[model samples]
Target: MYEHSSTHPADPTTPADHPAAPDGNALTRQSPFRRTVLRRVLPAVAAAGIGVAGFAGFAHGSEGGRAAAATALSRDTAPGSALTARAASVRQAAAADFPTWGTRWVVHASADVNSPAVGLINKSAAGQDRITADYQVDTGHQVCEGSACSTFMAHLTGPVTGFLTVVAVDIPQDRLPGVPVHGGGQPQPGGSRQEMLDRAATWLTADNGSQVPYSQAKVWKDGYRQDCSGYASMALGLPTPGTNTVGLATDRSITRPVSLGELKPGDLLIDAAGDNNNRHVVIFEKWNNDAHSSYTAYEQRGGHGTDHRTLTYGLPGGDAEFKPYRPVKFGD
Candidate 1:
């Protein structure tokens, strides 16, 4: 499903997993700015007795005032309210109750991932919306936010694949600063976050068994000897091939420093020792929860080609010496 122009690589530091936030949002919920996770099995807010009129007013008034509450309450429980049928459609993209690999789906956005959204961002805004968000799944229809509504349906439609849960977050609402949002909520196989994971899983579980060893300065498309940084580069679609663990931390185009609180899937975390040949780096996958204790990662190190592993949070004593970073660009 993915077309990697280059190849996937690995990390140089730890031999474990990375970090990701799982802020759940399907079509609608309250608390817009909190860390979010778009879920396949969404919570029914109808029980809350929130009204849609309030959200419609919020959407219109906030655009003019630009002071939409950091914690906007959910629009009332109207099927016709903001989190409409389309949002529900996106919420059901999972093959099962949660997101996982192999679930199938589609993505529809207002505009392409490269475009800018001035207004009327998404009708597909599902789950609890956040300014900075990322989307993932096993397979199913997934709708992410963009400048415009990519789907012509004016309704729910992002046929999923491999996983469920469409991430349709609207960014830059009036005075809100433009934060990092996922590409038009759809399956962009050319080079998308989900595609990157799909490609990595291919190697991890090939029919003939392709995933092999971890090689420093190695870029073999053949048997795929992905090192730690190499695996990171390939999965993220970076221009560099043999970028080592040190290069990942130092290279600007590849990544920029960020806080551990803002960590997302595909982000990076270098150890306290800093970037270098011997020091290490790992691609953040996802955290267990808001506690930031345990997490998953993707990398190739310790002679392993490439793998999805788990690790604990914190410094040597498990307190977190994370020199966290985010990818500047994955693919166009």
Candidate 2:
């Protein structure tokens, strides 16, 4: 998972929130621009480079495994070989240590908001070089100043919160609620971006409040807190763990990064600045024009704890661009 504490560059007004691009093109009026749909494709080659299942118990196991281990101890821990060995050991140890559904464990460090937001530690993924402990904060009545506000704000409300879950555990910006944004607080069946977005919108209506998960849909100013990628992950109903990446729309914390061309409907587009980041997550309605025309990016903004609008934005502008990273789809 990516860290949120790193400094982000200044944002160049986006078409999603702003009406036009820096080039004087009326982004709000354009139609069918180049649209990228991010989907849960297979794990990238780099993901495979890291071990996926179980801890390392092969040290005293099979014949071939033992010889490989001996070679590893002798050699300077070869690339793939050392990684595999280390992953295996981690898997075994983790399995024995934490007997749970998921092999991953979420460890937290004690943090004080008044103090700085650094110096915490954690155990990194097996065979990996770093540790992976996250910070845990109990939201009290006090309100935080900026993005750290989530820790001070109340549980989020609105259609977005219902289909919500913390995608990035490593750098926990907000205490992600384990509720579905659309499917009545439970995990809904996966489907196309339109399907998910439609479901969420439908549930967002005042009449459907009874059917959705949240107690009410009123904008709770502090009810929910999310950056761009966090909003996208919640809207898509993707697992919290799978939404880890390094750069682009998600801040590398929400859903893991995928091929830019593989953009999906209801995908998140983000540009972060010093204190806050500009975010836009919408459904990729269709691909139109000769790849130069405007595309539809549907999103629900502002109406968070207030009456907001779910509008469509034109794409491929300063706020929108292709971000390619080692794709790691979120799931078990």
- What are the per-residue Cα lDDT tens digits for candidate 1 across 1-332? 00111121223343222111211023232233421222222222221221222221112112212222111211111111112122334444431121111111212111121111112322233431222222222222223322211121122222221111123323212111211122222223244455455434444532235453555544433212245555565455443233555566777866788777777776677643432333445667789766776678765554344567776533234424547877676432
lDDT (C-alpha) at residue 161 in model 2: 18
lDDT per residue as tens, model 2, 109-204: 111111111121112323321222111123222222112223211111221111011211212334423211111221233334444454234323
| Displacement of the residue 68 alpha carbon in candidate 1, Å | 60
Ten contiguous residues with the weakest lDDT in model 1 = 73-82
lDDT of 2 at 158: 20
Tell me the TM-score of each prediction against the true structure: 0.39, 0.30
RMSD list, candidates in order? 18.5, 22.4
Cα-based lDDT at residue 271, candidate 1: 49
* Candidate 2 residue spans exceeding 4 A from truth: 1-195, 203-231, 238-254, 258-260, 277-280, 290-292, 303-332
- Candidate closest to the true structure, highest TM-score: 1
